[model samples]
Target: MTPGRLLVTGAAGFIGFHLCRRLLAEGWTVRGIDNLNDYYDPALKRARLSQLEGHPAFTFQHLDIAQRDDLHRLFTGSRFDVVVNLAAQAGVRYSLEHPHSYADSNLLGFVNLLEGCRHQGVDHLLFASSSSVYGANSRLPYSEHDPVDHPVSLYAATKRAGELMAHSYAHLYDIPVTGLRFFTVYGPWGRPDMAYFSFTRKILAGESIPVFNHGQMQRDFTYIDDIVEAVVRLVDHPPQRQVDWPADPATSAAPFRIYNIGNHQPVALLDFIATLEECLGRKAQLELLPMQAGDVLATYAEVNDLAALVDFAPRTPLARGLAEFVRWYRQYYGTA
Candidate 1:
């Protein structure tokens, strides 16, 4: 009872892992590919893969998208209906340290994906963009309609580059494409590099946690389930070129669109830490620090277009999501 075969790059990643599980549950034949790079912990990535190993409709492939030959071979053999490109070297500070990595994976790898989708004639291609693309904007809630010309970080620049790249392919090849601008996504089985996850670990170990920007930061923290729900809904609703397509950067005459998938609520850094403390039943020792390079003061998403299109929006409260994450953290680490 499978709907169609779909290819999800970075299938072992945090968001990709959750998306793969959801797609498999819905009885879709999923071809999950990942390079399994040691970006954080390969062990954690393998653990996620272990959960999907026995699924009847899931197949795992170990290959780097940056490797042109392997990627071409994959697209030549498999006739996929949709391709979700979530594979990228993620992290703002890390991007500063590893600019070449971002160029290799986020830039070159994405071109390979576009080429694959073009040749394979993929019905739709959904990719993971970042809210960080709204760089240097003083606006309260970032919107798709806003201009995203200035990117403060290499990571954000690459993500914005991906959007432009995808738009070009859609215009040239008429491939239907959607770019999701995810904001501060967090939940169970999340990346350890994320502040919440690392903060939990440090708090449990009675260590000091670094509070950046003098604890003035805010984020539109979206739950993993909410993200999965939004993505699932949009999969059935590929972007169609509008009859009266304006000369706008947000959309195009091509079948391409971008949506900010996030909880519109922006929580302050101190309040978020308080919620985490309540969840873990422990207070954190904070070391206030200046804002790091390639860091933003806040991120709030304007999801009106997403709501209008999907008839849904992310509604998970921060307290509940943090509680769930804490529960999983303690159990996963045997610290409960």
Candidate 2:
């Protein structure tokens, strides 16, 4: 049995595209929206949309979430049971280059989603946050309990800001909201701007791939399938306002909650690269570089809370995931 209608922002994006397909397969009616901006390649966005276009249960809308009037009209026109917001100007390094883009999408656009949900009386609002919010906190396996006061980049700051902003709306308007702190999501049809994707491209072209932080950094890279599964399960379980909620940042008196969705297994950069090399049957020309600004040395997620709730965690092995990605890359690029 399928649920009611869903409005997925950034539907043409990597995660969003996968999520829409999942919902549609489960027999849910989904309306997907994407501005299709030239953040990377609009052609990729179109390709994602092409898959969904054939599905009768899926509809695609072309618009920016930051556009106030359009967003309002969208909410006014449809009675969406859930709104999964995955749209934003992504890339931590790119955030330094264009700070205002973060303001436009992460900040301004986030508010628009909040307003739309508040007015539309949405049942649940699930939005994308990031592991980067761990920022200056030197904690391993970052938990929602940790204080994220210091953000290293404009991108991290804006994501943290979005969480705070969502809490306010959840408190005042009583909107049921869940902020998911995603830890380095990667898989087939993933974003080209991401390190793994770009590295694969450069490696195939026989060019030097930038090995940042001297290839010392580690990440808990979660597969897209695991991410989609967890989110789909969580949709039916919106947080209820707790009578005895703690003052801790993890929970609230409002109908709001946050969870870290990750594989929880941190893989070293060099090991990851080696696995990729095996998958592609080619060695990458390495350019060892110092850690870029606004970049963290490591990311590990503590998904105990999510496990307690859903009895599930991302369990995909890094090597297996990389192999799948490499397979898709070759097929998609017609190099296989």
Candidate 3:
């Protein structure tokens, strides 16, 4: 299937930048937009954009989706076959302090994007939801069928809200929508705030790394390559209206679907650190700490729905993924 034009929000961020590059490589004209805020390092975001800037099929825009007028203009001015939204005010703990940012980006910005799709009529609208929405579920392997009513963090709440909003749009306007519940996606050129990225840096700098929950936590640590592969395969497959649906929350009588994309293999925090140490050839000084606010004990995703839908399964092992990240980190930071 050939795509006409595509618009990717948060195009300079970790996932967005990677997705844009892949789209361009597959001959899709991608219009990439980002606020490039100093949530982490704007320089890193710019660096990611630099690689895509040289590509003939890529176009960059310095814009924020929270700005309704700007976003409206972009959607009206351009025709997009698919709109892959990867932009949001990320970070669970950070949302505790800067609550307004989450409201603006994840809540308001999300509504704006949904409105755009509703008006313009895109073939498929895919947005990045998070596994964090499974807050307080206590389930071992979180499923899309599991209810996500209790989100401890504002970030998670906002994501859950986005899903609801998307469902409404999908039903009202008949726009095809897919919500991806990504589980701890990490790899080369990942976000600095992520534990793996920060751990690698602190370990290389000979500093003690913070281990939350006294290293008792487990994560379905998915790799970026696997994440990208699932998304690329899903772009062509839009969900149809299921009138005979047996009250499944994941899909309904509307053109809406949700899938959990993860490695489905939860790794212990302690063992994850050990792998990183081996990859860097240096052990980390551990600062074991109690569980922080808005932090969950574990996140093990049941990617069965994703596997069945797109024939996708995240196969990247933590050690292998961390090794790749370590290699990129050393080269990117001149640590080696």
Candidate 4:
């Protein structure tokens, strides 16, 4: 599809910021919105927005998607060819205390987005789901075909609920929709709440980094650029209505589909830390902790379906990605 006006929620977020920058560089007229909540740091969010404010094709707004009237107004006012929902109350541990925030952004906000798409005649709607949806599934390389019914965390539950909501909208209204289950995405401008980011901070400060599950964990740490590449490639290729639905949960008779977006390789936690140490040239103080509630042991993505559909290939090495992130961290924080 030709470049056109696009709406990207959570434009100040980790993935959202990178995506908006890439879209603007490619000549897409983009409208980026975010609640800019103090989930982490509003300063970081503002900094991300600053990077995009210079682009002529990009516009920023401080609207919360959960607010029905404001979201409806934005949808009706703008002619967006593609709509990507990245706004959500993200963080597994954080959700335990703030369940209402999860409900507001991930559930009610998603419904509002679906309604907006339904009424506004959106050609394609894409939303960010998470590998956390694989909650209790011990299966290696989590596939979109796998049933994601058991979510350990409220955050994961909300993400899965958003997927169900999108499917419902697609079935009832024939809206072309795609759901992306992104695995442990990390890189420059990443979420501070994430393990890798926090670990970096602590390692530099000579503080102990918490290693949950007694360092017996694995993660499919995907690079931000890899995630951006997958989204851009899949943007125009909306799923068509499947008359004969495949024998998979990912595809349906409606104009909807789901795919796993990840590196397709799970790294052991200890080995990941070693790589981080190598990048920072400093050893981390490890604090082994028991398995935390609502935490998964590992996350591996089965990206064959994504590859078949959009030829998605995530090829960033752990070392290289971490090196780049470390470089940015030092520069951004004025640390040696």
CA RMSD, predictions in order: 1.1, 0.9, 0.8, 0.7
User: lDDT per residue, candidate 2, 1-336, as tens digits?
Assistant: 248899999999999999999999888999999999999999999998999999998989998999999999999888999999999999999998899999999999999999999998999999999999999889898999988999999999999999999999999999999999999999999999999999999999999999998999999999999999999988988989999987878889999999999999999999999999999899989999999999999999999999999887787898899999999999888875
Deviation in angstroms for 22 in model 2? 0.3
Full-model lDDT for every candidate = 0.93, 0.93, 0.93, 0.94
User: How high is the lDDT of residue 311 in model 1?
Assistant: 90
Error of 2 at 84 (Å): 0.5
- The sequence of per-residue lDDT tens digits that candidate 3 reaches over residues 1-336 is 596799999999999988998998888999999999999999999999999999988999999999999999998899999999999999999999999999999999999999999899999999999999999998779999978999999999999999999999999999999999999989988999999999988988899999998999998899999999999989989889997988887888999999988899999999999999999999899999999999999999898878887798777878888889988999999997
lDDT, model 1, position 258? 93
Error of 3 at 61 (Å): 0.5
> What lDDT score goes with residue 270 in model 2?
93
**Position 25, candidate 4: lDDT:** 83
lDDT of 1 by residue, 62-146 (tens): 9899999999999998899988999999999999888999999999999999999998888889999999999998888898998
Sort the candidates on lDDT, descending order: 4, 2, 1, 3
lDDT of 1: 0.93
**Residue 145 error, candidate 1, Å:** 0.2
lDDT (tens digit, per residue) of candidate 4 on 1-336: 999989999999999999999998888999999999999999999999999999889999999999999999998888888999999999999999999999999999999999999998888999999999999998887988889899999999999999999999999998999999999999999999999999999999999999999999999999999999999999979989888776679999999999999999999999999999999999999999999999999999999988988888998999999999999999999999
Candidate 3 wrongly placed segments (more than 4 Å): none
Lowest-sum lDDT 10-residue window in model 4:
239-248
TM-score of each: 0.98, 0.99, 0.99, 0.99
Question: Clashes in model 2: which pairs?
Answer: none
